[model samples]
Target: MRIAGAALNQIPFDWAHNIQTISTAIAQAKAEGVELLCLPELCLTGYNCEDLFLSDWLPESALAHLQQIRPLTEGICVVVGLPVRLHQRTYNTAAVLRDGEILGFAAKQFLASDGVHYEPRFFAPWVAGETTTVEHAGESWPLGDLTFEHLGVRFGFEICEDAWRPDNVRPACRLRGKVDLIVNPSASHFAMSKTDQRYNLVLNASRNFTCTYLYANLLGNEAGRIIYDGEILIARNGHLLKRNQLLSFKEVDLEWADVDFSTPLEMAGELVPLPAPDEYRELNQAMSLGLFDYLRKARSRGFVLSLSGGADSSFCAVGVAEMVRLGVAELGEEEFKRRSGAFDEAKTEVVQTGAGGAAHQTAIDVDNAAETQNQKPDTANQALVNHLLTCAYQGTVNSSDDTFNSAKELADSIGARFFDWTIDEQVSGYVGKIEGALGRPLTWQTDDLALQNIQARVRAPGIWLLANVQNCLLITTSNRSEASVGYCTMDGDTAGSISPIAGVDKDFVKKWLRWAQTELGYEGLRYVNDLQPTAELRPLADNQTDERDLMPYVLLNRIERLAFYDRLAPAAVLAQLIAEDPAADAGQLRAYVRRFYQLWSRNQWKRERYAPSFHLDDYNVDPRSWLRFPILSGGFSEELAAL
Candidate 1:
């Protein structure tokens, strides 16, 4: 028998879009002679419906929609995921349909509640050994702990969270002798290098159960904050049969394989090991795809960035470039523009004609012979980027000449419309008003923070007006290290519609910039890569650097991981720091630890108010997604004192 799995990019409750994608997948499967097909978990209603799953009407609506899909499965056995309401509770279930008839539903026995998942809030875990019936449209079917048969092959299910349990307790363990195939429909999220762990799980499950295993996962940024890699796998007896290229740009990606359940295959030397995962390349793909979905789904025209010629902002600019490059590569130029919903026939002409050029704006010139030599000329990718990205260098007197050159060269190299403007007048006006009100001239020695922050705050209004006028998303440049210790001004640098790198750390951002520059062929990054990171909100004579204002970003990131991801107390974090950094002075490590705890405790409000950010790495400091803290705590005074 031939088996298949499809990964779908679905939107929450978009009835026409979701059903159309499912119908397309079913048609393709039937055409390819697939005997059994597995769709992603909750592909009917989408997995990220949040609290709507708790409402009574949602499950009912999902059931009503299921009827629409039944007729499409006339020739093949199809497994679909949706919410099934029974006895005043909702259960995440996989419904089996064979030749236009409703078979049984297999309810998920485990609910995921860790990290970004809160499945327990909206779903009730099914009892392991219990079976029940669900009535819909005046018809009833079995709804729990069930198995089915197709083409003389017995099969059972392990929903997304079910297989994450221990081997002895998972559904596959129980179905070992009873079934010949185990199908898992998942809505698993994408993190850096997380696919390897999942690959091991599926291979081992088949070996332990002596059965063929098929897995499917949801794809793309379904709603917001979470991205699914859209992975599909088919294996038998610990040997891998099939896996798709993840993070696809297509709406539906399907993979299939033929398996013979009659013959018992030897497990020895059957498994083919997947090559080591490259996280740098992985992040590039995930971030590019995430931005593509967010752009089209939010109905925004394009992206507007405050390009300060630093690592974080430069990283974002390249992300948009990569989005256009990779998107147009997979999806043809016409389809990519159509799917974006930003560029129409009229807009495409405007982009190609260079109507949005920065000729009228002040332009900065870079004095590097190598930069001029390495700059790329116009291409299809650059032409699309010219339309999709708009950048501005909002400089003040404190801003540097090197950063201006950095911003302009990168924007030019990527074909992004670049504008160079000064914010010194606005900063001076605000400072004058405050000085007049206080009847004293503000000096750096007396009002250091106030003087520095006014410059950052003043740059927000003009960039916001540009974003508003162009109908673009304003990109915030703060990284997770800045977010961890409140190293940013609230209404200043943190003001944006999206924070792309807030889930990643500053140390990684800097290193990734170099990697992208050298390996990814973005020669414009030479400027930013050569310069040290700084706010430049202080006088040039004072020589302000990020490390001078805060601790080293490496140490800051380590402390953040220990405190939040590891859930360590202040004293424990200090002890771990000592062990990790043995060459560092003990007194200085204690001071850095104390400073980190104090800043973290007082900065919960900032993290709470940040724009929605992607969950890229294994963990993030976003208060709403991965971590939470009190807005007004004791500032960790007692804990720091003990440290």
Candidate 2:
């Protein structure tokens, strides 16, 4: 029997679009002679519908849509996921339909609860080997974990999280060799090299169970935060028969393969060449796709950033440049422009190399552009950036001339519209008013934090105006490291619609910045890379650097990972670090550990207040998405005192 799995870019509660997309996928699968097809989990209500699953109306609406969709699956057996309510309890369920008839419902046995998933709150796990009749659309149908047969082929299901369970609740019938197929509908989000893990699970299951495994996933930035790579894998007898492209820009991506039931299966290694894990390259690709989808979804004219020429801001700017270059390369210039709200018939024309997929020749290679001077970048891809990204450098008395030059040169190199403005007088306006209220002049010696924060805070309004007047998304410029220690001002530097890179750490950002400059051909990035990471909010004479402000970024990340990832205490962290780095000073390490614990404890409120950020990896700092820490804590005083 031939089978198909479809990956879709679905929007939440978009009933009309969701119905049309499902119908289209079904028709295409039927046309391709696919006897059975599987789509991603929660394709109807959308996987990102967080609290809506609690609503009775959502389940009713989903069932209503399912009835309309049942007619569309006339010729092929389709497994579609949606929320099913039984006895007022919701279950994450997949309905099996064929020939315009409902077969049965396969309720998910495992609700993923880790990291961005909160499925357990909304869905009850289905019991294994327990079969019950469920009332649906005025008819009773089979529910619970049961292996069903269709046209001489036995089929079973392992919904999104079920397959990952260490103690799988598969009925004895399945292990006894009665099941010939295992279909999985997943809304798996993208993380660096996560596809490999999915592959291993699919391939191993198919080999061990002697069945063909079909896996499908959601695609793109579905509900603003998590990005789906739209992966579709078909593996049979330990061999990957077919796999769809990852991170596709299209709305619906369906991959199909012909499965011959009569062929004797052999347990063997994979024959296909598995791609090596290049997370840096993959990260670049994922970020570009995510930013583009966000821009389109927000329907903003473009993006505006307060570019300080630091790694964080440069990363955001370069991310925009990549969105245009890489997007144009893949979709072709016309399609990219059409999707980007660029309606000018003549404006979207990009020079195609006609060399297969390498259409845009301007991918950040330094040798490509020797001139560092400010001019409309000779690169063809710069035109797209010029149209989409507007950047400004808001300098103050404490801001250095180096950052200002770096911001301008980088903006000019990338063809982004650049504006230079100084807010020294404005900084004094607030400082003077506050001093007047206090009946005394504020001195830097007594009010350093307030003075520095005011400098950062003063820069927010003018750049905000740049974003507002231009109708663009103002990208915030704080990284995970700074965010961890509350190194950023509350409403100052943190003011923006989205914090794109806040999920990632500062050490990686600096590493990526250097790599982007020297290896990735972004010559403009070299300036930022060369400068030491400094907030520069303090006077130049003080030589204020981010490292001096807190601990070293590398050490901070290590201590954080040890504490958060490994769940270790302060003394344990110090001991581990000392053992790991024998040459490092023990006293310094202890001090760093204490600082990290104190800062992390006191800064939970800042993390709670950050704008919605991208969910990057397994260890996310975003309180809403992954990690949850109490805003009120003892600053780990007792934990530190023991050390």
Candidate 3:
């Protein structure tokens, strides 16, 4: 028997789009002669519908949509995931269909409630050894913990989180000797190096249960914030059979392998390990795909960036370039443009006229005659990038020449449309107005933070106007490290539609820029990578730096992980930091820890107001998704005093 698993990129409650992708996968699987096919968990309605699962109409609509897929399974056995509502509750279930007839439904017995997942809030766990019935279209089908037989072979399910449970409690343990195959449908979010753990889980389950195991996952940024890698795996009794290329820029990705259930399996060769994953490459692909999906699904024209020529903004600029490079490589140019929703031949004209023509006439335009033609003619990827990315250097009087060159060169190298404009005039106007209202002149010594923040804040309006004019998303440059402790200016640098690097820390951002410079061949990164990381909002005489304002980024990230990810208290975090960095001074470590806790407590409001950010790592500080804190709290004062 030939079995297959498909990873689908679906939109939430978008009936037409979801059904089209599902139909495409089923048609492709049937063409490949796959007898048993398993789709990702919640593929019918999409995985990230948030609170929509609570609505009876949504689940009823999903059930109605499932009927459309029934006829497509005329000659094949297909297992598709969807929410099955019984009584007043909902259950995450995989329905088995054989030759256009509903066989039965295997409901998930485990619910994921940890970071980035709140499944238990919406789905009730199916009781073990229990059977129920669901009625649809005047016909009833068996639902709840169940297995089915097709073509003399029996199979069971572990819908997404069910397989992640303990070996003793997971559904597969009970189906060990009872079933010949175990299929897992998942909507696992993408995180670096997480695939290795999943690979082991599937292969070990098949070996322990003495049955063939098949796994599939959802694809792309399905609804925003969460990215799915669209992985597919097939294995039999400890022997790996098939695995698809993960994070593909495709709507439907399918992989299959032949399994001989009647004959004895040979166990001569051990399961060959998948090549070690390079995190840099993984992030590049995940971010590229995430951006592509966001640009198209949000129905936005493109991305507008305030390219500060710093680490965070530089990383984002390169991300857009890589999006064009990787997307065009996978889906051809025309399809890539069509899927992006806003990229068209007219956009090319907009770039030539709007971006180019306007630059020639403004006094704020710092470009010389030679710099106006920075985008090369022969590079098709660059030309596509020019349409998709529009960047401006919103410089102040305090901005440096090195950063200006960094932003321009990098944008030019990647074929992104570049503009340079100074916000000094606006900064002065705001400062003078504030002085008149207060009847006092604000000096840097008395109001240093306000002085620095005004320069950053003044740059927001012009860039926002540019983004609005182009119908593009404005990219915010704040990363996870800055978000951890209120190192960022709210409504200033933090003002944007999306924060791409908000999940990753500053330490990683710096290293990634260096790696991108040498390995990824973005030579334009050399400028930013050479300079020290600074906000550059202060006068050059101050020689301000990020590490001076806060602690070293390495130590800051350590404290953040301990405090949030590990859920440590203030005293415990300080102890852990001292133990980890014993060579450093203990007093300064204590100071940094106290500062982190205070800033983190006060910044909850800022984090609450931050633009929607991607969940790239295992954890993030997004209150809506991973972590939640009160906007008003005690600020950890008592605990800090003890430290």
Q: Rate the local accuracy (lDDT) of all candidates.
A: 0.89, 0.82, 0.88
Q: Between prediction 1 and prediction 2, which has the larger lDDT? A: 1
After superposition on all CA atoms, how large is the RMSD of candidate 2? Answer: 6.4
Write the residue-wise lDDT of candidate 3 on 78-155 in tens digits.
Answer: 988889888989889898987888888889898999999999899889999999899988999999889888889988
**Each prediction's TM-score against the native?**
0.95, 0.92, 0.96
Model 1 residue 137 lDDT score: 83
The alpha-carbon lDDT assigned to residue 556 of candidate 2 equals 92
Candidate 3, which segments miss by more than 4 Å at Cα?
Answer: 266-271, 350-378
Backbone clash pairs for candidate 3 read none
lDDT of 1 by residue, 114-227 (tens): 999899999999988899889888999999999999999999999999999999899888998999999999999999999998898899899888889999999999998899
Predicted structure 1: lDDT? 0.89
| Candidate 2 lDDT over residue span 151-185, tens digit each | 78888888988888663454322443778888899
Q: Could you arrange the candidates by lDDT from highest to lowest?
A: 1, 3, 2
Off by over 4 Å in 1: 269-271, 347-378
